[model samples]
Target: MASKDSIEMDQELAKRLFTEGATVVLLDVPKGTDFGIDIKSWNTGENFKGIKMIPPGFHYVHYSAVDEFGDIAPRVGFIHWFSKSEFLVKRWDPKEEELSSEPVPEEIVQRLKDNLMNLDRYLGPYPYDTWKQWQELTNRIDSTIIERCAPVCGYIRSALELENCDDKSRPRGAETSRKRKRGACLSDEQKEQELLPDLKPKAGTELRLTELPNLHYPEGSTPAEITKHSLDSSYTLDLLLSKLKQPIEIIGELQLAYVCFLAGQSLDAFEHWKLLVSLICRADSAISVRRLIYIEFLRTLEAQLALIPEEVLYDIVASNNFVYHNLRRLFANIESNSEVDARLKSEAVRMRDRISTKFVWDFSNLQEEEDDEAPVVVSLDAE
Candidate 1:
C-alpha cells in the first residue's frame, strides 16, 4: 500500500509536526534524528495569561551545524497547496532569498518536497512557476537518502515567497509600527525607565556608567553624573541607551557621542551617530554644526582608549549610506584634508593622553631628571 520512499517521508514529517509546539501530537516520531529540528525560541520564556498562546515558534532544522550554512529560523507556520501540490515554509524576512536554496541539507529538502506533493490531495492549488523553479534547482543536487528515488520536477520558477503576516501585526513589528505610533512616540513607560513590575526586568537593566578618571562633562551631566558612581576606566555610557529611548531632536549630542566613543561600544556608538544624523536633518542652524559633530566623532574613534578598530570604524561611519542624515555637510574632515589631518590628530593625541593619564597612568610634574642629554644638546651645539 505504501512506496518505501513515501512511507519514510511521512515518518519524518510526523516528527517535525509533532515536536514543533504540538501540544496534542496525533503522530509519532521515529528513532534517531531525534526531533529533526533543534528549534529554540531564542527567548527566555513566554509571558501571557491563561487564555493560552503558542510561543513565537522556531524550527531548528539547521542545514549544517557549522557556521554560515543555511536558513535556520523556524518557519512560523506551514501551509499546503493542492494545485501545485507543494508545501510552503514561511519566515519573517519580507524578501525571498536564493541563498537558502543551495545549502539546505539533503534529508530536509527531500522531506519538504515529498510532503508538498502529498499536500495536493488534502490542500488546494499552488502557483505552478514557483513550484517548478524550486524543483529545477533542487533536482540538480541529489538526495542521497536511499539512492534518491523520485525527484519531483517542479514547473514553478518563483523562489519560495512565504511571510508570516501574523507576526507583522505584533507590537514590535517594523512594517506596521510606524502606522500605529503615528509619530507619537513609544507608549510604554519602559521607554522612559519608568515601567511597572512585570515589565521592569524585561525593559533591560539600566547599566551603571563607568567613570574614567580623566573624562569631564559639562553641566546637565545626567549621563556623566551616572558615570560618577562607576569604577575604573569606565567612561559613562548612558547617552547611547538614552538615544534609543528618545531622540535628542537637536544637532545630535556630542556628550552622548563622546560617551559612546570612550566606552568603545561600536554598536552603541553607531546608533547614537544616527541620532546625530537626525540632528543634521534638522540642522536649521548652521552647516558647521554637522561638520563639527563628525570631526568630534572621528576624534573619539582615534583616542588611545578606543576599542573599535580604525578600519571597521571607518567602514561603519564613513559609508555615505547615511548621507541623507548629513545636513551640515557632515564630513568636512574628508573635504579639508590638511585641516582635518592637523586638527583631528592634535585633538586625538591630546585626548588620548588625557584619557590614559587619568585612567591608566597618573604622575605629577617633577624636575628631578637626568640633565645629561639636555646639556649635551644646549651648550656644546649652540656655542
Candidate 2:
C-alpha cells in the first residue's frame, strides 16, 4: 500500500538502525512496569516491547519490577557498554521478580528481526534530556579507568547485600577483627580501614569506585626531611600545592569518583574521598607556602562543598575530621596576621568568614591567637 519512495526510506532507516544503533530487548517485562535506560524512564504499557536506536557507549539500565498485588521490588540498576549494532537481551522472571539469565533462543531473535517493522512501533527511542548531564558527570573517566574499576560481573546493583545482620554491624567482614588479633603493626589494608570512617565492603549491585593507592614519599628522602615535613606543620602546605598541579586526567578520576558516589551511591567513591582529604590535609610545609596553600585549599573546598548535593553534605561533614580541622587551622592562621602582605591577609580573612557564614560553622579556635607579625615570611630560595 506504501509508495515506492516511502518504502525505500523505510528500508534505509532499517539499514541505519541495524548498522549503527544498539538494541535492548526486554522479554516479558510486565505491563505498567517502570523501566529506564540511562537517564530516561517510562511506565511501560502492554504495547511496549523494548528500546532501539541506543548509541554505542556505557549506559545504565534500571527498573522497578511491579507485581499484580502492587508491591514493588527494590530498584535495581547496572552499567553496560553497548557496541555498534549490538543486540542485547534480558528476560524478566515473574517468580523471582528479577531479571534471569535465561538466554533468548536464536530462533526467537530471527523471528524478531523478521517482524522488525511491526516491532518498531513498540520500541522507544533513547532519552536525550539527561544525556548531557550524564556526559558532564563522566567526561573525565577514560577507558583505562573504566577497565580498571568496573566490576568483573559486568553490572552493578543499587543495593548491596548485607550479611550477618544479627552479629557485628560491619558489612565488610570480620577481617578487621582478625587483623587486630594478629597484631598492631599496620599494613596497607589496616591503614585504609583506619582512614575510612565507614569502611564496609560493597555488596551486590553497588558500583565500586577505582581504588587509589596510599601516598608515599620519594625515594632516598632523609629522616630530617620526614621530621621537617611532619603532617601538622608547614610541609603539608607544599604537598597540597604540588598535588594541585596534578594533570587533569588524574583530577578527573577524583571528580568521577565524587559524581559516581553522589549520583550512583558508590561506596568506592566514598573511599576515594577519604584519601583525597587525607592527602590535602596531612602536608606540613613551611610558613610562607602554608599561607599560600591555605588560600588554595579554602577555594577548592568551598567550590566542592557548593557543588555537592545537599543529601550528601551530612555524610561528608560527619565522615571526615581532616578537612574541618585544617579549615579551622587556616582560619586561625589568618587571624594571627603573621604575614606582611595585607592583601593576602584580607583575602584569607574573607575566605574564612565567607565559609563560616555559609555553613554556619564556627571555624575559630579557643586557643589564644598567635602574635601579629610573629615573624617575616622567609624567601623560598633562602638557605
Candidate 3:
C-alpha cells in the first residue's frame, strides 16, 4: 500500500486533471519552465470540476516510462508541480545510450525499475479480463473514473431539456385544483381573445392635451388644445386592475401595465404586474411555459420603461434585484441615460448605495416601499 503522501498525490493529480485528459505542467527546459501538453489522466472517476472531456493514454508526451532525461522543461528547467508525483511535458527525447558501455550502475538500474513500477503498477494499459477489478479499484478513490464522459451544460443543452419531461412534474392535488377552477379558465380565455391589445396603438387613448402638454406619441404630432378628455368608459381603470390579478394571456397583463402607466398609476401597475410575475415564478428558476411568459413580459416592460423621461426616472428605480437589474436596463436603454441627462438615475444610484450601507445595521424587509400609490410624479417639464 502507498503511504499517505502517495495517496494524497493521487488525489491531487486527479483533482487537477481536465475532462479532456489534459493537464498543465511545468517542465525542465533549457531556458525556463515550459508548459507541457497531452498529460493524460489515469483516474477515470467522475469530477464536477476541472477540464471537460475524457482522454486516452496514447496522448503525446515528452518521456515514456523508464526514461527521464529530455528537453521537458526547457523554459523553467523544473516541473511546475501541479500535483504530487505526476509530471507533464509536450516534447520528449531520451538520452543517447553509449554503443560500448559497462554494466548498468545500481542507482541507474533502480531508477528505471521505479519508472517501470510507476507505469505498469499505477497507470498501464490493462486487459479486458481485469476491467471489473480496475473499475472496483478506481471506484475506491473517486466517482467519475469512467474513461469516456463529456461535460457540456449551458444555455444550449438547457434549452433542449424540454423534451425530457423535466418540466411536467405536478404538485400534489394539482389536478383537483384545476378541476375546481375549471369554470374560471374558459372565461379567462374568452376575455383574453376579446381584449388582446391591437398590435399598435391607434390614435392613442385621448388625453387632456394640456395635462400632457409636451411630447406626443407620434413622432411629429404637436401639442393641441388643453381640453381634458376623460378616459373612455371602455377603458375603465377597474378592468385593467382586474386583468392584472388574472393574466389569462401575457398581452392582458402587459396592456394593464401600459394603461396603468398612461393613467398615471405607475406604481400600482408596476407592483401589481411585477407581483403577478413573482407569483408565477415563485422561488423556482426552472424553465416552463409560465417562466417563458414571465421572461417575455419582463422583456416588454424593459423596452417600454426605456421611454420614461430622464428627470423622473427615480420613480422606476427599486431596491429589489429583479426590479432593479431588469428595470434599470429599461431606463438605461434611453438616449437620456448618459450622465449629461441622468441626474435622476444618479440619484437612484446614490439611494441604492445608501441602501447597501444601511443593510449592515438592519436585517429587516428590504423592499423599496410596500404602498401601491405612485409616490412622486416626475414633472417632465421641470428638467
C-alpha TM-scores of all predictions: 0.21, 0.55, 0.20
> Which prediction has more favorable TM-score, 1 or 2?
2
Clashes of 1: 20
Q: Which regions of candidate 3 fall more than 4 Å away from where they truly are?
A: 1-251, 263-267, 280-286, 318-322, 325-383
Estimate, for each residue in 1-383, the C-alpha lDDT of model 3 and write its tens digit.
Answer: 89999889856744544222333221122222222222222322122111221132222122212213433311111111133223332222224220111233556545543564343332322122333332221211111211111112100010111221111343222243235445654577755744542231112211111111122122443332111111111112223334333333433444334433332323434455555443332222122223334344444443444444443345444433454443333223222324223443444345444544643223123333334412333344755
Per-model CA lDDT versus the true structure? 0.29, 0.60, 0.30
Better of 1 and 2 by lDDT: 2
Q: Give residue 118's error in model 2 in angstroms.
A: 1.5
Tens-place lDDT per residue, model 2, 1-383, is: 99999889867866775569898888888897878875567788897888888767766677777778877655665566678878877778888776775777888887887787888788887765566666655545555555655655555444555443322665433355445647668888877766655444344334445333333444566655554444344343343344433334344455545554544455656577656555544443333444544445445456556656665677657865345555665455455545525665677678777877887877665244335413334355647
lDDT by residue (1-383, candidate 1, tens digit) is: 98999889867754544333222110111111111112111211122101001111211121111113432332221111111112223221224321122233556545644664353232211122232332321222222210111112211111122233343343242334235546556756635532221121111111112112233334466644434422111122233323332222121233333222322232443455555444333222232323454454444323322443456546644674242223213232233334344554455346445644643422222222224312222233444
Which is the winner by lDDT between candidate 2 and candidate 3?
Answer: 2
lDDT of 2 at 294: 45
Worst 10 residues of 1 by lDDT: 44-53
User: What does the lDDT come to for candidate 2?
Assistant: 0.60
User: How many times do residue backbones clash in model 3?
Assistant: 30
Report the Cα lDDT for residue 60, model 2.
65
